[model samples]
Target: MNRRLLALVAAAAVLWPAAPAQAGPATPKAPIPVDTYLRQALDGTGLPGLSAVVTHGDEVVHAAGYGHDSTGAPVTARTPMRVASVSKSFTAMAVMTLVDAGKVALDEPVAEQLPEFRMADPRAARVTVRQLLDQTSGLADGGVGIPAAEATGSPAEYVAALRSGHLAAEPGTAWAYCNANYEIAARLVEVAGGAGFGQYVRMHVFEPLGMTGSSVGGAAADGHISLFGAWVARPELRAFGARGGAGGVVTDADDMGRWLITQTGHGPQLVRPESLAAMHAPSKVRDYAMGWGPSDVDGSRLLVHAGNLFTYTAVEAIDPATGYGYAVMTNSAGLYDDTYEVLRGLVALTRGAEPPPAGGQRQLIELVLGLVALASVGLAVLGVLRPSRRRWRLIPPVLPALVFVSYPQWVSILMNGRTVTWAQVTYFAAPLTVTLAVAALSGLVVAAAHLRSIASAR
Candidate 1:
């Protein structure tokens, strides 16, 4: 018996080391500091007030506001900014939730749901909710003049425009990012939820997500637009009359981050994991599914979308595998859309992987691409200006390469500053923008000369 006991004790001692090895090392949760780099980047670009939120897994480790409300008041996480097209993702998800609840069918035709809504092509009656989400509804870009107005019209007008819209492609055939498609989908939501689309999302999505400051489509209160400092005078409350599913929702970064947490199925009573998976699922008509666009980032699937509504811009992105995501809002639309890519690169870096430099800082690269585009026109101009030996061909193509790069110098400045509400740079930056105008004019001159030579030779 003594000999057996000694043998068992020896066996236990040998296995102890192996047990810890099997469990693996603990992953260190490093504190992700919000740097002045972001603030400087925004400042360097002369953006109005900006807000950013970053979350890893289920925890939002960073949420900060820079600049003031449009009224020279300090902006907080609760201070709302127009999320622009980011509203589409919420609308898409809300519609899908109704589908999951058996209140709406994904394959059902919009005409059937709302008979008052008819398409110019009677065959458009065959357009399904899935087709609209995938951007394959065969709808023309808003028609010449009247159609453009109708396309940008209110919800009722949007549906009326759809009925009057001619099919540019067959359903489920080509990709056309049509706002009307989403507007119709929002109508379906209205039909499905048996309430106004905005009201439904407010109760079902915003409140449940703990988005106290967020309002759906229309403002729950007046004064939606807030200005920061004297950087730009108080931007008035942007009209929310459209309330379409495409680019009409208002929420701050704080509420957006909370909603983003649910993208990974972390928030309360949010959409189910299965539902979220469906939103990310790729469609035959587009690489995008529902309200999200997908791309591989650092070897992981990242779902991303940006919203543009007049002067306000917003973006939301996440890596589903890592549950790492970011949301950024700026007062001016398209002012520094590329800056968001820099922020994305920072998130990638935090994940322990290296990302290339911020593309917005690469003035040389931008100049090269711009010149190349102008060169095509320049070639045509050369034929006219100097009678080139080449044929008089005009080929002008614009390439909007979505490259993500972060310059530490600029980023350090954007992130280090406090919420300073009185610093003004718009006046100086407005004149500095002349540099871009000069470059553009130079390119045009070269292109014109080439074209003139070509014409003279002909």
Candidate 2:
């Protein structure tokens, strides 16, 4: 599938709920069988494990887990899954905490706080704390080689690597979702808050919100899986270190309930109400606020964010106006919109509406795509073994290589003219990347064999 379609699928999963014209009276409706809905979603998506929590004001309306996790442990409300980019709001809140203390200014040039944040383009020097939070810093995905940094280093190293990278646009001119921007923001948290980034979040955001089951950097639960053609085990979590600011908070359904309650304007006041308001306010460049993006559900405003680290995918949505919010996490990653499905269903239930059946069409389409990829590989092998004299046949054998090699460039074009690295593509879409690589390699081998056969005949 093309990147645009993939993005739309992701977005639709999170924001496509059809809420009621007006929310029903504040009287709590009979509890929807959210546990049943989540179990059904897990079965339909073929996910090995899933966890979800729904909250209304300070009450946890529903919290449950379905299937089994990586280690064959029964997934539960206490199982800690990496929340992925949902961690962005935590980072934003951390920055806001600094803002609350008068240590950080939202619109001040980031370079004023961290002199080492320079990029190859001088314009990068003007990026503000607010721009970084809202993703308008022009850093772009792969600008600082985030995938590599995520794999082997700290957020500080990730920020340091960006010094050699160029900005994708003038600072504050456009919104380009970039983890590097958060990495910088996280480092600023360290400098301004006078604590390690993770330490700061734990002491302020996580603890203050009463999310006791959550932590900044901890081993992700074992048995995490990724879907290539089928479910396969993924590696255990590496030390996220400072990169936790971008996508590295781990929490369980029980704790997520508290986090959601806080977002819905309940729980402890971790940051001032005004700061929280600013964090959710849409930025000048896009519908994105600080770390959250705003969406409309019925007439109510829903703030949403989704996260994927290849092995795990998560999404959270909160309608602060209605005091309803939910978070979903899954063990496997692919095109499946299981998390969003649960979120939408729960949101519908909260509004006293019947939840729609979860759609498994994306999974089926991905399976078909995987089968086609395998067939291409077989065709390439057959062409090599049974060489044909028609030079036209060579075109078919060589085409897959060209397509796979250019996949990154095509994705960059699709993503609002922002550049992407092969590593980032592979990390985000492993199944597609692996299939293309196999097709490309097989095609190259076949094309070479065909050329040799033609030369010999000549």
Candidate 3:
């Protein structure tokens, strides 16, 4: 059965939707070699599996999976994975649907729908729904307050806390990345739809786009099929509260492929072409829009977002002008770098362009420096083995490395308040540098003492 399934998957890969013949003749269909690259990338990242889809013009460039399933089951294009924050785009879409219906005004203050919402700054009451969509909400999302684990409480309670949280800056002053604002907008979605937010999305959004495998915050009642072996039933994954508007989506490559098509205005499933253009339209925040971020990828305006939820990561992007897009989801977060590369490659193939390769002097310098630093520290630590252990010496090599990595990310954090780049630098610098410095210094001191003792004996 597995072999047959694999064969079927391979066949589907070749026979997937083709770009129109009007897309400038046949253009000689060549094997993109993306599957092989994806496999190798996944191997290095320790990601259990990945599913990706690419569309060129109207053609489905590729839609396939590589590696073992999230649950060690056979991975197919249909394997459901939590899309994490990527669901934010869908949430924005849902809210915009209400906008289309004239059920909610984008410029209206959110306090009109949820009267209980408040913030530390009285000016926060003036924050409009459009501000939230654009991520200009100046709420305090800093410090160790927010948990890294999955949120398990009622969505209402979670949103209430976010609404009542501190505001470090007035709304529209600067961009502040916070999930709370979206959760609040989601509450508005509930009231506007007169149904559970997830159900409304399912009925209007997912079902219409043929995203049957997509669910906000969880998989279906039948559970998700693993890419390698068996069905891992996730009742909790299915038990999403009202937070579906923020980060509660479970979907696969095929479904997302359909979404990418619709996003580029190739299909008439969701909103109109004008609305999509509006969604992709840039805001004051860098690369930010109504629900998506805009950037010039390969010389064309592209809408993109990457989702993160603990071990899982997903990214999706579309270039409406080129009628090309890509969706990539990984079951493990460790493969983030690989995921980015894979997504880039798929997009390049669809767009019929090769992206600039990543091998640069800076990357080489960092790689060599990292290795040399690691080896030096490791050797020093080996000489400092004490049974009871004692005070350790500190090394200076870490200071340079820390400064090198932290400064840019710190600048980004200071300028944009987005934790994505900020958190990356912080996570890689602080603990690693501190630990290695201590270890190397202690080892160097122990070695010196041993050498002095030998000299005295001689």
Root-mean-square deviation of every model: 16.3, 5.2, 10.5
lDDT of 3 by residue, 264-289 (tens): 77865477666767778766755588
Where does the lowest 10-residue lDDT sum fall in candidate 1? 397-406
- RMSD in angstroms between candidate 2 and the native structure over all alpha carbons: 5.2
Encode model 1's per-residue lDDT on 429-449: one tens digit a residue: 221122233334444555555
Itemize residue pairs with steric clashes in candidate 2. Answer: 70-223
Candidate structures ordered by TM-score, highest first: 2, 3, 1
lDDT of each: 0.59, 0.76, 0.60
Please report how far candidate 1 places residue 225 from its true position, in Å: 14
**Candidates 1 and 3 compared by lDDT, better number:** 3
Per-residue error at 18 for model 3, in Å? 37
1-458 in candidate 2: lDDT tens per residue? 11122452443245234555866655554645877778777777778888999998889988988888777888888888887788898899899989999999999999988887887888988999999999898887656654465555666776777777888788888888877778889999998888888888999888877778888766666544444546767664443422468787888898888888887779777778999899999888898998788866544578988876657778888887778888988876665556776677777878777676675655655565578678877887787788876688789777888988788787666555444567556544666677778888888888888888888898
* Best by the TM-score measure: 2
Candidate 2's C-alpha runs over 4 A off are 1-32, 142-152, 226-229, 236-242, 296-301, 377-387, 412-428, 441-458
Model 3 spans with C-alpha error above 4 angstroms: 1-47, 56-59, 143-145, 148-152, 219-243, 354-458
Better of 2 and 3 by TM-score: 2
TM-score of each: 0.67, 0.86, 0.71
